[model samples]
Target: MTVVVGTVCVAVSCLIQSDPVAGLFGASTFGLVSAYTALFHTPRLLALCWTAAAATLTVLTVRWAGHDLAFVVSSALLVALVVVFVTFAGRMTIWLLDADIFHPNLDALTGLLNHDGFHEKAATLLTSSSRTDDRFFVVAVVNLDSYSLLRSLAGTIGVDRARIEVARRLRDTARSNAVLAHPSDSEFVIADLFTEPDTSPLIERVQGTINAASARLTASIGVVCTPLAPVAKLPAPDVIDELMAVASNAMYNARRAGGNRVTYVNDPALTVLDAPPTDEWPDDDTR
Candidate 1:
């Protein structure tokens, strides 16, 4: 929209001035404005098209204003240089902005989203998924059951190494598009585990990654799925907190039974506790 306005304004200025000097000045102004505007807001194709059109228009303006061949050549060269400047400056600005946004959300050690960042980014993803035919999403938290034991054996340095290794493995084991978060030392959460099938294999794969990290390391994951049962209809960001808690409870249940297992819980009411076992509760209706 701004591009359209800028382009139209430049053409009008060129037409009204009807002088060679005015034409050259207008071309320069247009080039700078378009470049900056495109950098901030316009699409790549739009920028490309605008650059071509502006160059052509500049030559035409010079010729229309009765300028000599030398002036026309100069105008074209100036316009091209302006375009190049815009491209370089715009790219640098974009890179800096992205770094600023990403640095805040990332966990320094694992380079995964911190708890707050995970919720923010994952919510955006879910909103996108909501627009599609997909009816369900999965949230799973992988907890290292042997974290304390690993620390006891490996010490702080060894523990950090193990965590880095585990974080990498977790990143690899999940689907390419999965949103992963590191909320605490021993906990890693995954969102957009979108497949609706039984989550057992998924859990097993996560556990396997941790076990592979070290002989002393094993993990239990708690997963809670939403809107799969007729009674469940979970909403965005708000529902995420509830689901995480329910999944955490299920994870604890797995911890209780012994570690290195997967537990799936569907808590429609998002209950902290008092969630019936999977076999006993068919739906999320909680009192």
Candidate 2:
């Protein structure tokens, strides 16, 4: 659309101005405007192009329409300037939208995506993955061992500090292929997709990083690879829900095993599906 509009503008400019320099100015203005419209995804490059084009257009307007005070030409140029301003503003608005719509921070305690940003983006990623056959994904749920006890003993401020530390650790551990969401105070979800190989190793690396990041703190991780046993014919939403359920079950097992290990839904030991369990701190007793 931008290219076609630019071409038409150039043709019109040539018809209006028979001078070679005037036609060149018109063509260049059209090119710059079109480039700014299309290259908005690259902020630095778009900014350069926009600045140069605006300068060019200002010079051209001054050179051609000076001392004329012609209402028609002046009005057209004003309209064109407004359109260019709106175009720049549109690009900026999209950058803001990406931040607000796709990357929300979740409160570690409540288990909800703190803002709607993560929820919307996660849903979009799930939908896109479901449509592509070439993609396989896994969800890993992680929880800090006995994190609530710190909240109780140290007070709300202490708990908030711990949550921040945990979030920082998780963010550092996030891979390019992983989308991490906090679903609860103690729990985080890592959804990995678009990679050629399985994500088990990445999960392990993240688990190690988490353990290393917080001294005297450890995490119990539960993983659920999609296409689990008894595969489903249902839609992608159903499949994701099933994967989440499996991850929850694995989390339960991790807690049972003392909250310092990683467990997968397919782990043979999880077959029995024993009673509900509790998480306890190690005997370090450090506040």
Candidate 3:
């Protein structure tokens, strides 16, 4: 739309007015259009629009500046340069804005999304599934059991290594469409779609993966699988928060009962299904 409008304006100014100054002034509209494209559209579209603008400027300049090759070339080149400059400035502004918005939502150590990023992604996921009733939105919070003890025993470097390893294992276990976030130093969150209400298999898989990280390392995992049919009308952020809250509480319960286990909650009423105890944490002396 912008390209078409810009081209039409330039053509009308040059053909109807018959004044070289008016034609050049009207051609400047392309620069404005280019700026808009650079900010909101892709670089490919911007390039195509600028090419059309340059071609129009050249053709119109030749018709207006008759028999003067130097004047025509210089005028066309100047307008093209102005359009290019505007596009470059606009693109730089877009780059800076994107970096500012997304940098804070990334975990520097594990390269996963942070808390804010998780919320944004999960909200989008819920919004997309609002029209569907066959899917379940599963939110799980995984906490590294005895993490503080590991940190105290091995110091910062070992703790960082353990977190990275856990992140890797979770990434491998989660589905392709899952949204994973490292919300805290020892806790990771996962949100994904499931076809069934029973997520015990997934919960078991997560528990197994975390336990595989190290003999001494185990995780307390809490999960809540919500059917989209009931909460489709609710706000996505609210749903996400409720799910996370329930999942976090379940995780805390798991931790309180024992360090390494899986807890599941399927309803909003906070009913909990605790998994049987898994491999016990090795004695501190074993570390």
Candidate 4:
């Protein structure tokens, strides 16, 4: 709607100025073109089109009219338009892609790592951690308590608003080395980015942060030690499947135990506990 109104405003301004060329020079036109391309074109195609258009326009102006003030002005306008379009288009494209990747449904309250983003990033992290024997890493799965009640009482939209608030709090509380992603409506994954041997302190810090957020908003976290026993014979991606499964189980135990506690599978208490079973859940419901 903003794009449409801006476009109309640009058209009207051009008509008032009686300069058909002014339409081409207006920022609103650039904004409109950028919005249109973002809605329709893929990133690669958008880049190619903008590149070609810029080149063609510059070349045409240089050849058709000699290198004079008019030629310079046209060239400048063309360059500005291309830059504006590309800059805005690229930014919006990435924002939309990330939204699709991490916050698809936009209803993820307690904004933790969504499942897809967690697996993808956790795998990458595991691959890297495997190379350095000295480095220690951890994957923490966070499960929110009574999230269904929150949604039911506040409505889905209200739940979403709460999620945004919670997400911001999580970000504020996350360690410098943490990679946070939401994998479920109320679950988040935090990948510790520490290369040092001590990660327990960092994990504690994250847990404390979440615990401090709201008395009503409690989180049960499961930590899985990465590069699980029996070091891989093959160099693989930086994700440890065993560790992920273990952390997931710990999260399940946390949930089962009334939610709001940090549990680690490697902990003595969970040593004999069975791994959490998996439940089939919808991958995406983003409108």
Using TM-score, give the best candidate's number. 3
Global lDDT of each model?
0.71, 0.60, 0.80, 0.59
Candidate 1 vs candidate 3: the TM-score winner is 3
Q: Model 2: what TM-score?
A: 0.49
User: What lDDT tens digits, residue by residue, belong to model 4 across residues 1-287?
Assistant: 44445444544553455333443344334444555656665666545445544543444444434437575566557656665766677777777787777566443445455665566655665555444365455777777778889888889887776567667776887765566777567777777654553456756766676666643577778886533322322322323455566788888888888877777644222222243222333447642
RMSD of each: 11.7, 13.5, 13.6, 13.6
Question: For each predicted model, how many residue pairs clash, with residues at least 3 apart or on different chains?
Answer: 0, 5, 0, 20
When summed lDDT is taken over every stretch of 10 residues in candidate 2, the lowest stretch is: 269-278
Candidate number that wins on TM-score, 1 or 4: 1
Residue 18 miss distance in model 3 (angstroms): 57
**Better structure of 3 and 4 per lDDT:** 3
lDDT of 2 by residue, 1-287 (tens): 44445545555664467453454345445444644655443555444445545554555555556445474356446645664666666666766776566534644343335534344545556665433355555778888888877777878887666666667767777775456677667777877663443566777777787677544568888887653222222344545565677887888899999988888654232221232222433456765
- Candidate no. 4 TM-score: 0.53
> Per-prediction TM-score, please?
0.55, 0.49, 0.59, 0.53
lDDT of 3 at 207: 84
What is the TM-score of candidate 3?
0.59
What value does the lDDT take at residue 32 in candidate 4? 49
